[model samples]
Target chain A: MDVVKTPQQAAVTVEPPPGEPVPAIELVKIAKTFSSRRGIVTAVDAIDLVIGEGEFFSLLGPSGCGKTTTLRMIGGFEEPTEGQILLYGDDVVGVPPNHRDVNMVFQSYALFPHMSVFENVAFGLRRKAVSKAETKARVGDMLDLVQLDGKSDRRPRELSGGQQQRVALARALVNRPRALLLDEPLAALDLKLRQAMQLELKRIQREVGITFVFVTHDQNEALTMSDRLVVMNAGRIEQLGSPREVYEHPRTRFVAGFIGTSNLITGRVRAMDGSTALLEAAADECLVVPEAASAGAGVGRDLDVTVRPEKIVISEDRPGSGRCAIRGRVAEVVYLGTSTQYAVATAGGTELSVFVQNASDADDIAGRGADVWLSWRPDHSLALVTTQPAPAESRSDLSGGNQ
Target chain B: MSRSRLGARLTPYLLVLPGWLWLVVFFVVPTFVMLSVSTQTGDIVSGFQQTFHWRTYVDGWNQYHTQFIRSIVYGLITTLLCLVIAYPVAYWIAFRGGAHKSSLLFLILLPFFVSFVIRTQSWNFILSDNGMLLSALKNWGLVSQDFHILATAPAVIGGLTYNFLPFMVLPIYVGLERLDPALLEAAADLYGSKTATFRKVVLPLSMPGVFAGVLLTFVPAAADYVNAAILGGARTTMIGNVIQTEYFTNLDYPKASALSFILMAALLLGVFAYARVLGTEDVLDVAAR
Candidate 1:
C-alpha cells in the first residue's frame, strides 16, 4: 500500500500510461431532463467525463447538482437525454442496467430482504450462471473480504447499519465488473462509522483494482477518498482536479467556497504592481493581494479576494510587516478543542474569520471585544474576478455579496 | 395510590370493553348456541332437546360430503382465479398508478357501490345461453348456439371471483405499496433479468398481501350460497346451499347447525395447514420489517 499523504502531496495528476487502455467509462456531452408538474427541470447538463481504469473518481457537489444523476446515467439506470455513454469503448445508449458491465451500491443498501447474507452476496454470480461450487467459493471469499464470513445465514435486518453497508459493498463487488458505482453508500452510517468506512472503502478499491465512481455531497469525504474529483453546480461542472489542486487553486469563486471555508472580500482594483494588486475596499481601507490571482482584472475593475481562515494570523500586538493586514475587533471567540476560532469585525464593516491552533502557548488567544490585527501573506489571499452572484444558502458568503 | 394504580392497570381492558362485548354478544354466544343446537335431538315443533346426538354430525357429513368437497373446490378455484387476475392489476396500481393511485383503487371498488346480489345476477344475464356475450361469440363463430356458461361450475366460480376480487386486490396493493422501488433497481444492477427480478424481488416482497387476499377471498367464498343459488344448476350445489336448504326449506335445524360447524372446522384446519405450508412466520417477519 502507498503511504497516506496530505492533500498537497497527493495532488499529482493520474495521467494515462504511454499506451493507454480504453477508459473504463466515458460520458460524452450527456444531458438529462425531467418533465414534472413544475415543468422541465434539467437534472444534468452537457457533461463530458472520462474515468481511467482503476481510478477512484468522485462527483462532489451539493444536492440537486446532478452528481447522482451523472452516476445513475453511467450505471444505466437512467438514459441520457443527449450525447453518449460508452462502457469500455462501446456505446451503451439503450443498454439496460442488467446488460451493462457495471454494478451499483445504492444509497438505501437495497438488500433483498428475503435472502440471507450468503445468498445476497451470491446473487449476481448466480444470475450470470456461474457454477455452484465457484459461486459458493467466490461468495465466501467476498464475505471474508468484507469481514462477514461467519454470519452468512443472518438476514439483513438482523445486521447493524455498518454491516449492512458492507454487505451491499460485497454484493456489488462480487460481480467483478469493470467499474463499481457507489451512490453515497456510507451516508447511513454514524459519524465514526462513516469515517472508518471511508478508509475501508479506499483499501478495498486498491485491493480490487477496479475503477470506482462515487457520488457524494460531502466535500470532506470526496477529498479523503477520491484520486481526482469533479465539483459540480447547477448541472454543470464547476471545476475538476485532484483534491489539492482544486482546494489550493480553485479557478472559480464557487469552487473556492464549495471545497472549503473561505473568506471572500469584494473590492475594486486601485493599483497594480507586477504580481501584486492593491484593492480599495469599503471605508477607505486598501488591501494588497497577488495580481496573478485576478490576472484579467485591470485597474478600476471589481474583484473578490478569498483567504482561508487558517491562513489568517490573529495578534493582539500589531504585526511589524506583512503583505496584507487588516485591523479588527474580535466579535466572537469559539473554542473548538484543537483550535480556537475568532470572528473579527474589521474597520471596513466586514467580518474576517481567523483560526488559531490551541497550542500550549496561551498568548495567542483573543477575547471578545479585544482589538486585534489579522495578517497573512499576499500570496495566501487569492483575488477572483467578480462573477454572477452565487446561489444563496450555500454557506459560502464571506462578507456582503448577497445573503 | 393502590386504587389509582389499579385503574391504570385496567385502562387497556376498559378501552377494549365495547369491542369485547360486541364479539361476545354477536359471535361467541351465537357460536356456542349453534354448537349446542348441532348436538340436539328433536323435531322443530317439539322444541329440540340437547341430547349430545353425535350422530347428527356424522349424518350431515355423510349426506352432503360431495357438496362439502365441491364447496372447497370452488373456494380453491375462486381464490386462485382472484390471485391470477388481481396481482397484475394490483401491481400496476401500486407501482405505476402514480398520481392516480387512489382513483384506480376506487375503480377496483366501484362494483361495491351496487349490491353484491345484483352484481352476481348481472353475471347470470351476461353468461346466459342467449345473453349478449354468447350471442357475440356465436356471431363471431366462437361457439355453438347451445353453448352456455351459466349454470355451471365455471359460472359459480366466476361469480365468486368477481365478487371477492376487491378483497384480493386491496391487500396485495398494500403489500406492493410498501415495497421500496430501489430493490428492483438493485436487482437489475446485479444482472438479474426483468423476469428474474420480478420473480425474486417483486413476487416474494408482495407475498404478504397475496396471503391476506387469499384468506379474505377463500374463507368467505367457501361459505357463500348466493352465487351458487343464482348462477349454478342442481349439480353444482355446495355445502352452503345444502345447509341453507336444511334450515329454511326443510326446517331441519339440527342438521343445518351440524353442517355449519363442519364447514367452520374444515376452514380453520385448511387455514392452519396453509399457514404451515407457507411458513407464515417468515412472511409476517418480513412484512413487519
Candidate 2:
C-alpha cells in the first residue's frame, strides 16, 4: 500500500476471485468523440473496465453522461475513436455488429415489425443456418424464457410495449452470445412494469448464466439490479463498486450526490486523535470524522463529507461525546408513508435532511420551528476524496456543522 | 331545437355540396353521355342517332387490338424502367440525403414546373436522328447512322419514363422514410448481411410505396398519347393514339367512345389482377408497422 490512500482507484475496482476465467467484456481506454456542426462532442472519454462473466454489470449516470455510449461501443453499434474492446479476450475492433459475439436490446426495443416474435427470435439461428427443427425448438425455449410462448406467432406491432420488450430480449438472447447489452430496455415502460421487468431481467440473467451489461440513468434501478455498477458523470467514470459498497462508501462528490440523497458538509480538521479527527465546526462544537478519511491532509485542511439521511437520528436531546451531534430547528416535515423526512436548519445556517422510520404509529417527532438534536456515529460522516465542488443539490442541505 | 338538430344533420351535406356538384357536372354527365354515344350509329356528315348498337365495342377491339396490346406493353415496360431508375434514387434520398433531402426531392420534381407537352417535346430534340446528342454519337462511331432512336418504341417508352419518374420515386421515398432505421440496425445485429438485410427488411417494408408508384404511373402512362404522338412514328402508335385519332381527326364518336370504354375496362381488370397478386393487405400491414 502507498502512503497516500487513493479511494478513487480502489472503489472503482471490483476484483474477481483469484484465477478467474477470461472476462466477458473488457474495455481498454475506450473513447468516442462525435464531430457535429457546433464542435466536437466527447460523448465518452478514455476509460478502462472489465465485466466478469455471469455478473450483472451496469453503467449508470444521468442522460448524456456516456453510459449509453459506452454500452453502444460494447455492442459494436458504435466504434470507439480510440482504444480496444475485448470480447472473451479477442479484440473486437473493426468488427461489424453482425460479426460480433454480443447482441443488444435497444432502448426502442428494435423488434422487427414485420417479423413474428418466433421469427425474430429465430433470426440469429437462421443466419447461422441452424436446422429448422432446432431453430423451432430454440425459439420456443426463448419465448418460454420470456414468458411469451403462446404469443410467439403474433407480430411485434400487435403486442404491447412490455411484450415487445420481452421479444427484443428474446431476440437477442436466443443467439446465446458471450454477453448481452441492454440500453435502457425498461425506460419506456410504466413504473410498475419497469420494476417488475427489473426483477424478471435479473432472474433471466441468472438462469442463462451469460454476462449481462445493463446501461441506465435510473440510479435506483442500477442499485437494485446491478451486482456492480460504474457511476459516470460528464463522460468519465466517477466511481465503480457493488451497489452496497457504492451506496455506503461513495468515493467522489458526484457519486455521493448522484446515487442517492445525502447531506454534504464542508469542515476543517481541528485535531487528530489516533484514528479519528475532530473538526471545529464552531467555537465549542466539534464534528468527528474517520481519521483515515482525512489521512493525507494536515490540520486546518478543508474537507467535504457526506452523511446519508437514514443514518442520522433525530431527538429532543443531544447525544453523548462518543457520537457526533448537532442541534437544529425542524424547518419542514414530510410524511412519506413508511418514513418521515425532516428538513432542519442548524444554528450555523446549514440545512440538514434526516429520514426517520415510522415505527409503530410513529408521528412527526418535531414540527416546523421545533428544536431538535441530530446525531449519528462518527464514521457515518464519510469524507469524500475528490475535491470537486459539492453538487448543487447537496449544497442546499449542508449537514456537517454545529456552529 | 328539432329544426336546429336537422340543420346540424345537414351540415356535412352542405360542406360536401360543392365537390359533389363539380363531380356531377364534369364526370357523371360526361360518362353517361359517352356511354350513350358509345352505342350510337352515325357518320360524320350524316350525323348520328342512338341506335343502341353494342357491336361497336367488339368492332373497336377487333380493329385496334394490336395497338391495345402495344399500349399495355409500353406502359408495363415504362413502369418497370421507372421503378428500376427511381428505387435507388429514393433510397439514397431517404437514407443518406440528410440535410439536403428536401432539395433533392425538389430536383426530382423540378421537371413538373414545365408543361407536360413541353417536357415530352423536349425528348424529341434529344432522341432525333440528327439531334445534337444522337448526331454526336453517330459522328463518334458510337452507333451506326441507321441505328436511330427517333420514331421507335424505346423513344416513346423513354419519354413516358422520364415524365413519370417522380411518381415512382416520391411514393417509394415516403414508404422508405416511414421505415424505422432501427429495424435495419436490428437486422444487422441479428447477423443479417447487407444484402440479406435489404432483401428481408428494406424490400418488404417499402412494398407499399412500390405498389402505389406502380399504380400512379401505370394508369396514366397507359392512357397517355402525348409521348407517342411527339416521339413515335406510325409503327409505334398506341391505343391512346388510336383513340385520340378516332375521336378527333376521324370524327368517329361512337368508335372513339367504345374504344375509350374498352381501354378503361382493360386497365381496371389489369390493376385488379395486380392488386390481387401483390396483396395490398400485406403492404398495408407493413406500412402500419
Q: Best DockQ goes to which candidate?
A: 1
Q: How well does chain A score by TM in each candidate?
A: 0.89, 0.89
* Per-residue lDDT over A1-403 for candidate 2, one digit per residue giving the tens place of the 0 to 100 score: 0111223223334344578787888899998877666456777778899899999999998887788889878877888999888776667777777777788898898877778888889888888788899889989999999999899889988999999999999999988988999989999999999999999999999999989999998999999999999998777788989999999998877888998898987777787777566776755455788854443544778767789999998988767777788888999999888898999998777798999999997755898999888889988988787645545643323222111
* Candidate 1, residue A178: how far the Cα is off, in Å: 1.0
Question: How many residue pairs clash (N, CA or C atoms closer than 3 angstroms) in each of the candidate models, in the order given?
Answer: 0, 0
The reply for model 1, stretches above 4 Å from the true place, is: A1-18, A281-286, A291-295, A385-403, B2-6, B129-147
Q: Rate the local accuracy (lDDT) of all candidates.
A: 0.87, 0.86
Report the Cα RMSD per candidate: 6.2, 7.1
Model 1, span A126-195: residue lDDT tens: 8888889999999999999999989999999999999999999999999898899999898899999999
- Report iRMS values in order: 0.6, 1.0
- Whose TM-score is greatest here? 1
Candidate 2 runs further than 4 Å off: A1-18, A283-285, A291-298, A387-403, B1-21, B43-48
For residues B158-218, write the lDDT of model 2, one tens digit per residue. 9999999999999999999978887888888888888988998899889999999999999
